[model samples]
Target: MKNEIIIFSGIEPGKKGAGNLVYFFLDRLKINYVEFKLHFNKTPDGFLIRQLKNFVPRNLSKSLYYSFYRFFFKSSENIINRKVILFHPQSIGLELSINLIRNNFVYIYVFDNFLFCRKSYNYIDRNKSCLLCLKDKDAYLKYKCDFFPVKHNPHKYDDFLLTISNNLSRVHFLTQNRNQSNLLYQKFGPIPNLTQIGMMVDMEDVVFNGKKTVKKYDFLYHNTLIEAKGIFYFLSIAKLLRNYSFIVPFSLKEVRNLIPDFEDFENVDFLSIKWNTGLKEILINCQVVINPSLWSAPVEGALLKSIKFNGCVAVVTTEYSFQSEIPSNVVIKLPDNLVEASKILNDVIDSEKIRINYKNEAKKWFDLYSKDIDISFDKFIQEEFN
Candidate 1:
């Protein structure tokens, strides 16, 4: 008998980061898995409909679509025999699918935490204003009004919860300012059987180029100009380092809308490139990469990619800790303040030996992680899921 595992994530294929990670790992493992694409109506009127759905009678819209979707894409009876993992439950429609198949397999809820936090930098929040959608009906109305999923408790349907690390669990607990682990212990009362996994990076693409001449800059920042990414903080740093060049991967148009008079940065030169095509290229050509997210995951891909491409990375100070999966020479933890961060950037860029040492360290780290993916997957299955 062949063991089968079917994983479901709401993300579309070919996208970068999490979706790409999922696709790569599943393929590397040779796991029997099928990716389902979730589609939403893309139109100006769709936005209006989404707004109306948020504030109107929940049952009216939910019953209509729920029935239609179920009738069209009913769960296969054979699915009961396959082990299943549900990636994220933030999407209401996807939650419905989970409900339909809850009893058939091992139900795993992969928690990214930002899924529940209303103040996420990513535009993943369906209810923008409600902090209590999961607890109070009145709070749900204040934000979601009458969304169908809001009428039904989707969180209750999840059987097992998974997180990327202890830090991720801490964020989830901090989001509510409540000890979620203890809360889970109170409700479920002990689930030693539940599996907690760490997010894995594919180190195959990382190659160390020793002591390459780095572009001189006091500080470096990369990310969209959205407020949550704290692009303004970068802009301020750019002003301080009049000689430093700030490379931003946004079109003049997007920058204008996302930041007020963004072109006004005296020393900053905009490098117009979409993240999809230009992120790696930009990192390869820069000196230091700064990730100053007030609250975010370790941002492993960008950090590892920068080191691999012969650039140093400086992440902001935060309680959220990540294991240094990169070479020490290439990765620097920036102080919470931009001034201190700038000094660190200056010190590292001027030292060639530091760069060379980091490059060698990075090569070793990449080789270890790039060990046969099939063997890793087999071990993961036997130890983690079995």
Candidate 2:
């Protein structure tokens, strides 16, 4: 029989990290496959349904979404004995994940720590990186780290994680970061099927025009709105170097809410730009791209894109686990300490030669890492049958 594949994820293509990853991978995969993108709007649309959706709770909406997709997939003909690939299945809901495993051999690609974490980012109380949830079953409940709008029922969340752990043998697990894999192993003893697939970035998506972009901004903070990703730290660095121009491509109101007095800084410009188009322009023109993630972030998409630009210097935290993935020679590593990190950034900004030298040397490593990801994916596809 010819090999058939079924891919599942929550978001539509060309969107968030997981969505974009799914989109890019599918474009590259030369095979016969079917994709099920389970979104909130996948529900039936009508005058009554439209009015009801506004009042429907997020948790209830999730349950209905997953249940519908599960029934559709289960009832579909010619689905037997085909390989199932799940990308960010946590967003599809716990019931569907369990159901998929029961019927088919599944491969679960984990971009974040959603299986064991309530918030999925492993960032607790907006403070720092933590793995307490792995050891203490009640840690997520204690911290009130639920990302979804679910009720305060500890057992409800625990059941989701326990299901994954119990069925480890049935579903193959994959992660980009080594530390994430270690943490998973720590919690589940040892998952024989677990694989550490290296980091990946679509080189074609990051391709720049041969003509150089004129340098417009001295610094750029285009990371996620989440505080744990280091908006506060970026604010501190901007404050320290008030004269340097900073561009933040995010909504004015949202950025203001996160940083109450963000508007007070005259040097920083917050322009709400679309991810695929406008943001790419800003990335090419910017001199430095700041991605000081406070948590053990699996190599961020922003960081990966920033490093591609030879003129742009990517400044990231040395403390986080993602730092171990990239070679030190490519990007500039800033310390975790707030005061010390700010000083180093200030010094780097003052010296134009330092920026030019670092930018010039990053391309070789970028080419090598790009090749590694391609090789990793090739291996992952071949091992799926084994």
Candidate 3:
């Protein structure tokens, strides 16, 4: 009998964000599988219930939750010897509290610096994703380190690690998380079963629709306007570049309240991109799209779409996930300090030839890093088959 595949994620399947990419991969494979979400619930899996886990006897809450979930939602598909796949459980500040797989193959997907960066931002002080945890003993206390213990002391990391290392006719597998994998090496010396794979997005979703791609603005930064996202860096640069218009998703009035200095800059514009198509249109129309994230994002849908639009330069920090393997000419790296970043933006705004050249590099970047989704799923299918 073929090995059955069960996907476990806290991210809701029908959602439109990063987590949904896993769903898209499953759809492309035409493979039958079952999905169980850890979040998006109000009853047994709600916040109160999760908080209650801390008080319950160790291992009890985990077992109870799994038993209840399995009994209620086990796959109707009749394949034997199941392979359970987990993705970004730690992302939403939730943990399964157990990796205790009794009689099945387990596969885990890692996207962020979950173990090292408590906030999952994947960065340290210098706008860089420095692996401080491996070096600094006080790092966890410094960064608060990880989303485990959904409530507090609900599950121990030692127990989780032991479960993965232990086996009784069962196998534990993993997807490539370059950033985390690098840390794992420094922590445990070296792990034998590690593989690093670059993120891939569906090309059709981001492909141009034959409309003229005239860039309306000089710079664009959206998503969470938090310090971790490097929004403050973008804001500082925006202030320095007077001729260029900077756009975001929040109202201009609200932004002034958030950062009063930006009030005087008439070049700033605000329009919330709530829908996927709207975001795509914005990226398609913009001259440059930047995350400028302090976190080393393994994959970004916005970056993928902007490249598809053919005129957008993906400006980002010099982190492994974003800058690794991608050609230097295709994706430009963000400067470490505000002064340098502002100077670079000023140059981009002033030079027409430079903007035209960088814009032309978008297609090359897209084709190299994110042209196909099939290759990614193919590896999963092969792993299951083997």
Candidate 4:
């Protein structure tokens, strides 16, 4: 029998903001496969039960979610001896993916830091980027890096690493960037089965018309409204550059909740809308799109989309481990210091020649990335066929 591939992820492909590499490859390859997604909840919980969960400690509630996922997850024995490709699975789903390693040829696509860090974002204390957990297993709890305010288990990292190490022989890991793959090896030792596949961008989703229009906003911060994603840094920059017009996909109240000390800036326009075609238009129309994430983000979607579709220059935080492969001229990288970063952004905004140069380099960089993705896909397909 042909080795049918089982594609498993947290959700179904082709959903909103779900046009990821796996989705792209599946459509292009047309490989014989069946799909599986973790059901959030097969049956609705009682209102009181849901309320009780809210009252429960965040760590315990997180445990509950995993238990619920496992309870609803019905894995078929037919998957034995088959090929399974896990694409950006949730923590619980990742655990399940590890378990499948013994019985099947498992290919795990790493998008987040779930394997090393329990919090998975690889960020700490709101403003700092971290990767200490990769080498020192105690770093997660020692640094109090839980996503929620609740205390985390001390041995969570230890146990998670043990599980992954045990299943290493039967698994193949695919990282989105070469730098990400290198970081894994530098921290976790040499991993022979790891492959670096550049992130896939669907051209159909890109909103680039031939005509160039006037920029309505001076700066755009369309990332999630979270501190680790550098919303605070963006705020700081906004505070510094009060004269420059800024736009975000969040309300003033929502922004205030994250940065309680946030001021009501008249120059900042908040558009609370779903990230659809409308948001794409806004992104392309903006003079600059900032992705100041305080983490070793491996080719962020926001930054990639902005570079691929937007007419303006993309600005990002300098993450040596993540952005090492990205061309220096393609995107403007700012230092960790808010003041220094603000100065760089100011320079970019003021100089039309610099913006044009960055945009030109960005086109070359994106073309290289696209070619890498195509080559990676071809190699992956050849391996799968074999």
Choose the strongest candidate by TM-score: 4
TM-score of 4: 0.83
TM-score for each of the candidates:
0.63, 0.82, 0.73, 0.83
lDDT by residue (1-386, candidate 1, tens digit) is: 23545555544333444555555555644463434323321121246555655665433453444434433343444455455555433332444444434434434343333333333222223211223523432343444333223123335322212232222222211111123233334333434434333334444543433344345443446654545455666666677667667766665555665554655766676656544355555575666677654443434454445555654566554433342323344467665577876676667678877666666676665555445434555565555445
Better of 1 and 4 by lDDT: 4
Q: Write the per-residue lDDT of candidate 3 for residues 221-267, one digit (tens) a residue.
A: 85555556666667767777777888886666545544667545677
Better of 1 and 2 by lDDT: 2
Clashing pairs in 4: none
Worst 10 residues of 2 by lDDT: 32-41
Supply the TM-score for candidate 3.
Answer: 0.73
lDDT of 2 by residue, 52-93 (tens): 445674345554554555455432344445577777655555
RMSD of each: 9.0, 4.9, 7.2, 4.8
RMSD of 1: 9.0
Candidate 3: give the clashing pairs.
Answer: 118-146
Candidate 2 wrongly placed segments (more than 4 Å)? 31-82, 125-127, 148-154, 205-215, 260-263, 310-312, 318-320
Taken over the whole model, the C-alpha lDDT of each candidate is 0.46, 0.66, 0.55, 0.66
Query: Which portions of model 1 show Cα errors greater than 4 Å?
Result: 1-3, 31-82, 92-94, 97-101, 107-111, 119-190, 194-197, 200-220, 224-226, 261-263, 275-278, 296-299, 323-330, 370-376, 383-386
List the lowest-lDDT window of 10 residues for candidate 4.
Answer: 35-44
Model 3: weakest 10-residue lDDT segment is 34-43
